[model samples]
Target: MNTSIPLAASDAAATSPTTLIYWFRNDLRLDDNPGLLKACQKANNLLLVYCHDVAAWQMTRWEVPRTSRHRQQFLASTLADLAMQLKSHDSRLLEVEGPPAELLPALARAIGATTIYCEEIAAPEEQEEVAALRAAGLTVETVWQSSLLDPTDLPFALDDLPDVFTSFRTTVERHHVLPPPPLARPQKIPALPPAYAALVEKWGATKGAISSGFADAEPIEHQASNSVTYRTGGRSSFPYFLPLFSGGASAASEHLHQYFDRKLAHTYKLTRNGITGVDYSTKFSPWLASGAMSARQSYAVLKEFEAAHGANDSTYWIWFELLWRDYFRLLHLKYGPQLYRAQGLTSLPQPSHDARAFDAWCQARTGESFVDAGMAELSITGYVSNRLRQVVASYLIHDMGCDWRAGAAWFEAQLIDYDVYSNQGNWLYIAGRGTDPRNGRRFNIQKQAHDYDPDGAYRRLWSAQ
Candidate 1:
């Protein structure tokens, strides 16, 4: 059995001996990926690898798994798709479960790879990994692929990012750093050796064996699952808002096309605050959060729609939401450790801890029926509306007085579309320690429930009322 499948070209000088390793981190798709393209152009042979970091998965401080089965299933589906795509280019994704710090360098040595390419991550732990790779003398190149506007094109230095969302938005709007056009997908990918194919197949067959590599760190018990539900987050998962939509890069693109082509951009503002139904909101956040869809792609589609259909406040609000996402990312980069602290970005003293109260909140036993309903929904569905997210997050931090980090970490463990920057950013904001100019703006739970769920339909659905 020839495991080394020839994809694009087989006759390209096999004896050149230099290989390039493309490390697939969060950016899984081949479309609009600059790092993958650059790596392919530079090397005679390409070895694509997805390292399932056991250390990262196992080191959860909470009882919940850091990467939920919902996320795992989505990633597995994504990798399966990526493998098929790579085969079209004469490449394959070599899946391995281990610390990349050890696995990557060893694989590079084994393949005689001269360069390793991956998407750049700004989070503290991911940066540490990059530093460790450099310390090992491997030539690692990282490209910024997640953000809509490249970091280099930002209006100011990263350290100079504004402390307020409004200020950051104003600066960007004034200077207007447009996102670059999406990168074209390549027609072909370089090939690997027959020995590499055999190694990958053997590795895939015994992936569970390497589960030990990530065993030291306890897995957090996430409530989300891969079973088809309205809240699932896989390629085949139920469509939330925009039931016509699917869950992946291709689906997102199609949604954008119809929204723009049909001039539906004009009604975005009117329907955005809607609590139910698929078309009420853009429904881009889940994929955007996971790096399956880029903000720039959304922007481009919206612009095309506006050109054909004419721009309006509704059309602009989509950009406004993207700006909010960007604002959160910049906030994390600026505050760094402050965002992780107990008091958050605020100078206020940290809230007192109450273990029993915290447990009640987590378990949906809180006496506040509305709050409990939101909690139950999240526990069962792995999702809560943005309005409810604010309500529950505030109740957890202010009313219950739990550690904000604990709540954030729990969100990290459960959310299928959790982004480190957004998860931490929103948690800090709710804790009254973030960039929100109004400090400690805790939501009134009863008032919110009455307002958003007047008939108590939502509460009834979750069995919390």
Candidate 2:
């Protein structure tokens, strides 16, 4: 029942040389990566490379920078882990800070690599980079490893995709196009070229820039000055949801095993909306967003759980959420440029933009106490409850009438688990221009605040002024 796919003949041929390059992008892990596996199968020698595009960090149409420190910290941790993993396979991840378009191909040439293997990204900038690499005459092979459902196996073509999520979901479910099982980690990694040592040394001296667009109250001061304990990166992140589940892939796998084996899937429907603590929701999004876990792996575990424990509404709901994730990703692939436009996809009523109002929202100085608190929480912790995300997004689009793109950009800059598809899709949905049939369905801000935070506990924690 595995659905994993390998590269095409031409792509395989490109990697048939003595040395091949595996460029790590969003698919950061050593496990279940088709591109990495394929590269391992084809090459006798391999060079792993990661590029931090400085231009991407600095370029901003909105006020915020693209890569926030929170995301950078997470990425840095993951890269460190990835390097360790690669070392076991006899390869090392070469970290570089430059545009991939120029740097990747140049690095490939420098190391005498005939082929490049990497994950495929549908974003505009990534697509341009791919084109640039092809134009440079290197054999570039891309594996579609990002989504739960492969686009080629989708029920309908991208252009003909249903505008509504339910329609897309129904059609896919009816077609029964289940995702393939996750790929296993490759057993042996190829050796690096002798010259790669020099390239690695050159990149080692480059330091990552810290941007103010995504700063926080300094961590040391937060702990010492206020007697407040904050969970920093690494293993501490999952512990915050203590007594529920562990963090990282090993923890995620164990949680999946227990949920299926112990019939916890049956209870998910009852607890998914709970406001506080770990068991409330799956807590899989952060891991899934970063490629630490794969949608297919989660699905396989759920299916096994259902087979053993019996399927029910709770089991179905997990798939429902995963399908929603897939639907949003497809929407991104389908709309492409339109999704990035100021007006979004729908020809609906537009919001009024006032710089002063927008500035207030960004600065967490908005007059509404609840929305202001949520914004501040987002600024300081890089994490927000799903309830608050919808509430704050509604407040930004409906009450303040700010441009949705601005708000989406702010989330992109702030969220630690910001996936381009989910961030943009959710924003467009709130703005009434995405998959929603009813355009601009605004949430009742006051009612939501009262219902979700009746005692104002969340507000008290985050309200700056």
Candidate 3:
């Protein structure tokens, strides 16, 4: 539950003073970001900041770090590029090290910022951070910007959203509800206060500076040209990951252009279930997960593609997938913390957790060839194809009889494209604890391997690894 009270836009405009802080969370890009534009419009002296929380690196109860080295490297690349983008607009992302509730309030007080603007995240941990900021007496304004369709535009309230995806999709389509076009990136951003850099200097002098691996104690300079080089900094077992898809708005935009420019979307439905190679899918999840690309931005581009190439099942299916992502987000809002519980939305008996079985599955020694291949692929690379994700998750819950939460946690830790709402929702769905009309998703592993990888090439390739 989010405890922060909503602040009206007019109130924000009326009461805003000189200094403003725009805290970037999941929405890392400049374009199509309403909160960022509001920050730019409201601030006379703007300070842009992003906090890298230490909690993200800590180990979970499942004995895995909450985030992976590959994901961190991708994030580092994204932030480096985002910092450069901000620099292009006379601002820089003051890459701070600490909890946002701690660092943001201190920085806001130091710079005398009256308002803090950010994207609203509905997840439990993220919600607590926002609540903490409000409790600290910051005038925090948040926009519900993650979904393709705005909550206000929905035909029904979020609490009334249908449990099943099909019903939700039908209602939304019947209402003719659509997402508005994305906002453009600002041409120029407000300059940081000259005295603002002195806070870090003061902190360094007092030995109170937070040790963010990405932050430097030097004054954050806002330059005309971006000087930072984009590199996936940390070591990763998934060498095949980042090169295939880099982070930040630049890469996302370029990929969108090339994907539609080549008319690849026409065959999306045909190859979306494929288990190997890049051309099998659009591969936009990584960018979408990090907020480097907005859903509305993707939808707008998708509409343009439809206009130029004519609407087809493939294009419609692309929209369907986006809607599914939106449905998970809405479901999170409707269910709140129930979405994270072991029982989920159902009254099903809690599944027993076996740490030893989970360990074997995680290490790819399950001896189930297809499951092993999928797990091995995920273990070696921080990514798995959608078909493989379903297969692996089903095997974990149904075949191995392990708890779904452990599998969900592993996915959270490992995937470069982990979105909390979607990951947890999908896990619960597979475990029969969530929005499933039938008995939930249980794939026949051997049959799946035969149908998708008859040649056994994918199994052979990943099993060797």
Candidate 4:
């Protein structure tokens, strides 16, 4: 029952001229990706492939769409940027629409691929994809490159990981664990074989060969609207800080540099809780979640800034948050599918589900102004502050008493930067079903508003229109 997949021996032992398929999953960027580097090293000819999950466009059990237009558009932009980068390096991204389990094996066979290289995602659905590919006799090479700290450097084994964040952080810090410096971007990626490229184009062109419905789907633009829209630059509303916030590796790196250049990390702890505007927090989560930004890359830059600017609590806290990210990733290794259960990592009876209450929470008709404002922002822009997220999540589970998974699923559907590990872990934690020491976390909505939005500015800003 061991689900932690290792790179196939055949793939690892691969030498000499060979055709390889580099399947892009969560790790979308070219920089600091060990899997992509491995692919380049092994590939005489590479075929870059991205399969859009057709299931992502459909509704979940909660009745809301699994992925919103904003997230889908962001992904499209990311793919387009990746495609441009590949072309510049004598390669191209094959964008198709279908389950990776089905599309990948067929595509690999069609192109004479012997191996596939991809990021190792521990979640059930992602894991299943790799298993299926291997079952099809393709050697799949999976890399663990998502966390700031590598699993090998952890103070304990995955099964022995600390149950709480504080203990895990303290132990790692005590052991002086540091993430390796970010890898430099590859100068040039291996080119796809001309014949393979032609085959990819041909398969993509075929209607029934791939997920035909969204194969040629286009990236959507941010339109200005009163309800849900991407236009965020204006008074009386929290501006989205658009044009600069496009999804891609370049954009992620640029924003990281700009944040440090402007000396914004110094005040991150102070303003991270603010509900409105772009400057309130680092806003790196979206890129980081989407794999446009590497946790190690961001950590390396943070250390460089601290070396020049001197260390402070804020700088240290940024790294602390990253440690939390790593902690959840490790927790996945420990608990596996238990993290997704109704009573996650616990033996408590399942939490009750209420459809009507859940609908009200999702619709932002929860009668709590702060919760409504946060939900509205998430609905409209596909973004919300960390503080707002906790507030809304607490309100949903504690005040509304809806199933935590329902709320987690809603966030999954709407968030532009959704990461499965963090999304599920956080939801389970708040619901008292995961690794929370106190069992469950409850927030006082009135007090949260009074503290974070004293003048009711955030509530007024989002509630209007």
Candidate 5:
């Protein structure tokens, strides 16, 4: 989340102050926020709110937890960090437990604010939330801030986005496309209105503050990771139990600097595919997934590192991986609700979902060693390696003959870094759907295990349970 570029104050700063509501969605940090920054510039007294969607905590169609306890624990850290930042600026974030459309309108009326501003999410359910908000007769403004490259800067229209990733990459590279510089955090924030207290009392809206005692605090050493029914064995690749790998902008920025200072980018391509430990990968996804880190901030720092040292193929590979992330997001903008369909933009018939087989896969009761081991690690740690993700996903769809959507739902439930776009896009690609012109992937599990887990280290690491 570190940015090297100099930041300028907004030209459209502080227009006729009005009471407004700024809803915090995926983009949590204030450091590089376009939506929150705009809210600050226009508001005299702003009500900051975040809603814990009931649906997020409920069961999915696949009969798995939509979001796991561990995922919520990590989110609690991020929310705590956000609250501390707001507190520094003499503001408070109201944590409500309900859907946005239901809670926000009442909260907006309570605060006497007619408009709600937030980040735009391109997924189906999120879009429905926004549409529902508009139907309630409120002005809701959404900013597109998640992507590194601005969609307006693209050489081609979204409707014409290349079907293949290679074509998309070459087109952008050919145009020498670059993301806009990261913005500075707002130095001065508007004060809360006198009505805020009455509003909170009248509506009884702010139920509880999860950020109460954990803001920027050190996590206990050797403490058990708070997960579902079971605790990790302390061999997690992405260890959320420790403070270093904990969720927040501070940790994310520190981790980013540590990765670059140690010059890991120079050998990233070589180590990226390794399926063990935190050192094998950049491990930036969790922060990025939660919006504690911005892709542009990471890119800006990468450019600085390249300037300080010399550029190489390894450094370029980092950018390559980032583009892959962007491509999946753009796919959402292009296909929208179709991406959520079972066939996923293909002429193929609906996928056959073996519920019993899927249950075994989810419980790690599947006899396949590599796949089960990977599933076990995910269940325990709320994370798994990118290589193993591909291997296990393929094993479920191609080998076990289970539905790809079922695997995606399980990932949605477990992954602390569960990204909707990437999860759906990758699942579609593996299932011979989505935008893959060559039609889906079918990774050979035996070959993958032999190639990556040559000495059976990864499998043995999670073999016992």
Candidate 6:
């Protein structure tokens, strides 16, 4: 599901409205959401549900919490904003906790829902969730909405997708493929059935009320036991503590428009790699990752800015980065579960794990200033510059001699903008397990520090804590 669907009112599903559920996964915004739009058209009365997967709160094999407080706080804010928008549209959101397989089916049976609609996520775990729902006797229809370019518009079949990103990018540009224009926010959201609303209320759950106990400060695994104080000095590159940077559609929209109004995209390529600033990079990943913003929405605005102000190499580079995101996603569709293999698509041997070194790296005590600074920023701020992400990731894999999967798991647990496709793809690329012709990427930390942080400002910025 790597394409945009133009949902039409005259479609077969819209012939007559039926009782259905709309499960909000990664695509959270009401704008340009083909899946949700279809649900709005096809549903007589829809139950808009978002499930907080229990596994996200539990510990991983690395003995770290599956998610950090920073990620949860941003998520809470995103869900809160989404609920508000839904409310203004005469609809509401139901926040439930538990696996979608268990919670959704019970709700459907309880409310007599005929179908469930959601955006298609091509990753293995997300695919499994959809399968589990069907196994439990529910019909789920997923629309592809994440990728910028539609799969049908691609010049090559997915199986023939280039193994290298440069080739993929060049081919896409040569063909002039473009994203479907972003759709407007839905004017109306169908009201919830009285019976369905009563049933959930009787169960002691209402809009904005959790159906399960998922508090923001739930006890974590090792980080809690060690009395680790998760705090930042408010100097983060992408600080979520501030209201302007808060999660959800409103902030995302404000940030998006202001970014262009300030004409930041003109210098995006030059400043995107800066280590210590708020506006150095686009900082859209947090919203983009949380589904609070859509990639198409961002691109449409970029094009609008270009139309008014004109385009340049910097503006072109912005789209280049977007293509990289789409490449990771299309890779999932082409290779499927192979991308999750320990050796990835290559025949490389298993990566060895060094628990002690890995733990030191996670705690920001790796004895390497550059890597430690980056790791510290990630742990406390849940956000790091893209350059530092590559640097710290390379250090953990090639220098610390740890399993790449452990590093990926730690990132999944900590990073607020963690996308399954990008996290896994980047780790595999750095570990030499993926389709890299060079096999692996090993950064010279000293040179990187000199090139990116010549005055040691970034290192000192994170050192005091």
TM-score of each: 0.86, 0.86, 0.89, 0.91, 0.92, 0.92
In candidate 4, stretches whose alpha carbon ends up further than 4 angstroms from where it belongs are 1-16, 205-241
Q: What order do you get sorting by lDDT, best first?
A: 6, 5, 3, 4, 2, 1
Q: Give lDDT tens digits, candidate 3, residues 1-465.
A: 999887899877677657889989989999999999998887788888888787876777988667765576678778878989887777767777768888888888888875799999889998999999999999999988889999889999888999889999999999999998999887678888676678656532211332233222111121211221112122222332344467888888988889899888999999999877767788888889999999999999999989888989999999999999999999888888988888999888888888899998888889999999888777655778999999999999998889999999989887888998899889988999999898688999989999999999888877555
Alpha-carbon local distance difference test for all models: 0.71, 0.74, 0.81, 0.80, 0.85, 0.85
In Å, residue 459's CA in model 2 sits off its true spot by 1.9
Estimate the lDDT of model 6. Answer: 0.85
Predicted candidate 6 versus true structure: per-residue lDDT over 1-465, tens digit per residue: 869777786775566557889999988789889999999887778889998887787777887777777787688789889989998898888877678988889888887885899999998889999999999989999999988888989999999999999999999889888998988886778879667666556542433443223323222322331232334545767767677888899999999999999999999999998988889999999999988899999999999999999999999998999999999999999998999888899887888889999999888999999998998888777889999989998999999899998999989888889998899999999999987779899999999999999999889988845
User: Which lDDT value does model 1 have at 434?
Assistant: 79
- Write out the backbone clash pairs for model 5: none
Q: How would you encode candidate 5's per-residue C-alpha lDDT over 145-261 as one tens digit per residue?
A: 999999999999999999899999999999999999999998777788667777656543332432222222111222344542235556788887677888888888999999999
The alpha-carbon lDDT assigned to residue 11 of candidate 4 equals 63
Clashing pairs in 4: 232-239, 232-240, 432-439
Consecutive 10-residue window with the lowest summed lDDT within model 2: 217-226
Q: Which ten residues in a row have the lowest lDDT in candidate 6?
A: 217-226
Residue-pair clashes per candidate = 13, 3, 0, 3, 0, 0
How far does residue 213 in candidate 2 sit from its true spot (Å)?
11
